[model samples]
Target: MRRVLHVTDCYSTGVGRAVDTIVGLSPEHEHHLLWAGEDDPAGKGFASTTALPGSSLARLRAVRAAVRATGADIVHAHSSRAGVYARAVPAGAPVVYQPHAYKLLDPRLPRAARTAVAAVERALGGRTDRVVVLSEQEARLAARLSPGAGRTVLPNVPSLASPGVRAPQPDGPRRRRVVMSGRVSPQKDPGWLAETAERLRERDPAVEVRWLGSADDPELTARLERAGVSVSGWLPADALVAELTAAGVYLHSAAYEGFPISVLDAAWCDAPVLAREIPAFAGTGLLTVADPAAAADRVLEVLAGGAVRERALQGARDLLREMNPQVQRQRLAEIYA
Candidate 1:
């Protein structure tokens, strides 16, 4: 069996789930994970190490050492940071790099920083055997960043193993709640969430909103709380799933994304999803809104119970089927090959 080393600096987000799925499903190949971060759920089995730190130089050195120690035949680097580090190291192993999302596309960054990151990505493209992206938008961005780089589109699939119990639609009067999961950072547009919650509460004081993730910014956390939105800071998977299942609707307001796993989870849980009209979510069949007000309206429509709600739920199911794990497994095997 070919020994494949998976290297990543981020092991807490959707990227972590992708890594876990790859290693868990592909038993034909020996997998080793060299990762950085505490509480990395993906580093549970097989040969693994957390020697790499987040710093560029440190991660490069650590990855090189891991490659030498493991004698890895193929090296798969995940996330932009790890992708840069792993590609920088000329370890003679075939390298596959997957940038969960391009750093250059982040609008929060300064123009100069974005340009510099793009230049770095272009320079490193030659070192990568293949560049894997999760969406068509990302594939297009990758091509622009590196003109002739070998590329593959491997869409993310929801993990079926931890499918949460679907909460039955309420037959009687019940508390209405809208839920969202992910880190409360600029990327997620916490400001928009806070504003949306305030608008939603104004329309219906009884309506409640909850964010099931850790707060990266204290100011944003306070804003959300002040807006009458409950922020559950990073619950365990089971607990988060339970919270999601109980919710009447799922809302997503990310400024950007490679592909959101939480949206997939919400769809699998049968919660009607109303997400922002972002390129990443285009053609996913989920109902998309332009702004927070539109999102709130969509959620209210789902809660009201009618043909709209039924259609939304059906759309969620269709998306879940489209993102089947078996199809992902086959595509992954080809990429690995």
Candidate 2:
């Protein structure tokens, strides 16, 4: 069997979904997942599973044990910390580092901390066989980080439950709803989103901003509630898809990102987008704004539901067709093989 060990800090719902797609496509490969913080939600679907604690010393021991136990032919890691440990794994084994996004990308991180992480990657990244980034901008950043590190871009793409059928749209009164999905933290900028939603409601009281995310901040839920924005804990996979399809507008206020999966999810659901001006969100015809007032204006324009909304929705669907996950998975298989 072709043995592969995949490592990640948390096997996120998205990461879980991606690994499921890979395994479903290639059954010939033996895949074992190791992660920090939590058990593998994705591994339940797999034929074999292993969960290990992710502490530095524990990781070293567990990885050494997993390497021996699984005889991992390829060690593929899915986050920054995992990448660091994967690189630290003994040489001669093929090591693949997929840092969904580098730690340095978060604007809230102290400059010294970001610099420290960057320096670490620069030093140890050369040891890895390859690095996979999720977007063109990220690819450029990774190239700059380690000159000799082999790298490739595997843009974020969504896979429908089935290959041939278009995803079903959920039936609902549009209600001028605007949705955002991600971890409710500073990186996602939920505070600004709450502020923007209040402004949007002032322009159109019918407008509702619903954030589907894990509330990382206890106070975030309180603040958003004060602004009349609906907050949901992580939804089940099917419910998430339904929620995305039902919304009229999708909002993204992230401070920084690699290639956001939430934006791609909204596109798949055919939700028109209004995003903060970010390089990764380019080409989608999204109303990109620099400030909260401008973002609210863009939201109001789309909620008006005339030529602008139709044009943006059609444009988003066109982009989604091109970025379907089958196209990306094919590219990923080729890169990894």
Candidate 3:
């Protein structure tokens, strides 16, 4: 069986979920994780899991040591930070790097910083055997950044539970909640959400805006609260399911992403989706909005429950088939071959 050694700095949030999905994609292969996060990914079924040293230099040294000790057939790095670690270290095995979302593409970064990040990626490109991407747009981006690395377009599957038909809420005016799930960060562009929530509230006081994840940024949290957007800080599984079940729409506002697992979960839960326009979502069948203003209008249209909502819901349903484990299993086997 092929053995994959995964290197990652993020194993607490979305990246961790992505790793879980990857492990399940190819059951015939054994997986090992060398991670920097404090919490171990319980139930991930790794052959072995190691925590990296605290410092950056130490982390790199630890990766080099792990590469030799594991005798891995493939070194798969998750995210850009670990991409640096895995590709910088000499691995006797082939290296497969998945940036999750390229840091260089983040709009918040200064042009000069983005350029520097691109240069680092180009310098390390030769060490990468393949770059795993979730979409064709990402594949083309990888081709430009990692010229020497081959591209592997692996369909992204949801790692979260489906939650089936939404639990019926108490009979009322029908909760008009637009929900966004994820920690408050620049990537999520809480500013856009704040504006959208305010505009939505002005249009209809009955409309509600809620976030399914934590309020990690104090400033953004304040803005969201001011805009009448409620934050459900890291809800329990049952509570999350309840919220998603009653959700009129799931809004994804990431300025950039590797195609989020939350979107997949939202669709699986059967909530109509409204995401911001970004390259990662191009041709994904999901309806994307140009701006928060447009998003507010779309959310209202979706909540109205008509052809627009049905069409929006249908897109996500159709896309779910691409993420079936069996489909991914076949692709993984072919790519690693």
Candidate 4:
């Protein structure tokens, strides 16, 4: 059996979920996780190592020691920060680096800072055995940023109790509620969501916009509330699933994304999805809206009851088929082999 060591600094977001999925789905392989934070999401079955918050050099030393102690055959790193540390260390194992989303793509960063990050990534490319991305657009971006890097696509799959199970829709009038799930950050474009919520509220007084996750920005959360958006701060998994199941539509207005797991969850839950026209979702067959206003209009249309909602639900089913976990498992095995 191949021993794999998965390294990650952030264990609470999409990166964490991806790592969890990989370990959980691939039971044939021996997986050891090296998490930098105290929150141990790797529950029961696997061996784990934790590192206290420290300088990069200190963390690198800890990771290197972990690699040797575990005698891992392959070292897989998740997210940007962990990628930096994992690629920098001479771990004596093949390194697989998956940057859930490249930091250089963050619009909040200044141009020069983005360029510098690109340079660092390019320099680190030689150390990476495989650069796994969530989508084709991400692969192309990685190629441009880090020329000569070996890149591959391994889409993130949702973790559902029953992989293909569909939620039953109520027969009566649908709730005039729209939901968005994810951490409220600049990438999610909370400002646009706030604007859209106000417009949607004006268009239909009964329309309620609910955000299922918490925001790092208190001011942005307050702004969304003022604009008549219900901010449900970070619901537990079962609760979040319940919210999505009850909602009429799922609206995603991210400025950019690698592959949003929440979108995948919505698709699995059979929620009608209306997302921004971003490259990351280029061929996912998801309905795309140009702006928040357009998204709001789409939500209104769905709430009004028509073929649009049916079409969107069909599209979501198609998306779920493409992201099938069994298919993903085969692809992952090929890569690891």
> Which candidate number would show the highest lDDT if scored against the true structure?
3
Stretches of model 2 off by over 4 angstroms after superposition:
37-45, 159-166, 283-285
Q: Between the candidate structures 2 and 3, which one is better when assessed by lDDT?
A: 3
Model 1 Cα shift for residue 293 (angstroms): 1.5
Per-prediction TM-score, please? 0.92, 0.91, 0.93, 0.93
lDDT (tens digit, per residue) of candidate 3 on 1-337: 8888989998866788778777866768889899966346766779888987888888888777887788788989999988888887676778899988888668789988988999999988989999998788788889998898889888777655523434434343436899998888788888898899988988989989998887888999888999999998876545766777688888898899987888887776777888898887888788899998899999999999999898889888887988656677777887777
**lDDT score, residue 335, model 1?**
80
* Candidates ranked, most accurate by lDDT first: 3, 4, 1, 2
lDDT of 4 by residue, 1-337 (tens): 7889888888775677777788777888888888764246645357765653578887787778878889899989888888888888686788888999887666678888988898889888878888889888889887876666678788788654333434444445446898988888888888888888988888888888989887768887888889888889867666777788888998897888898888988887778888888888787788888887788888888877779888778877888777878877887887688
**What are the runs in model 1 whose C-alpha is more than 4 Å off?**
41-43, 160-175
- Positional deviation of 156 in candidate 4, in angstroms? 1.3
- Alpha-carbon runs more than 4 Å astray in model 4: 37-39, 42-44, 161-173
* Total clashes for model 2: 0
- Per-residue CA lDDT of model 1 for 142-240, tens digit only, reads 888766668888877765344343334434443489888888877888878888888888898888999988887898888889988889987776676
Q: In the order shown, what is each candidate's alpha-carbon RMSD? A: 2.5, 2.5, 2.5, 2.3
The CA lDDT of each predicted structure is 0.79, 0.74, 0.82, 0.80
In angstroms, the error of model 2 at 47 is 3.7
lDDT per residue as tens, model 2, 98-147: 88778787768898998898889888867877888877777888888866
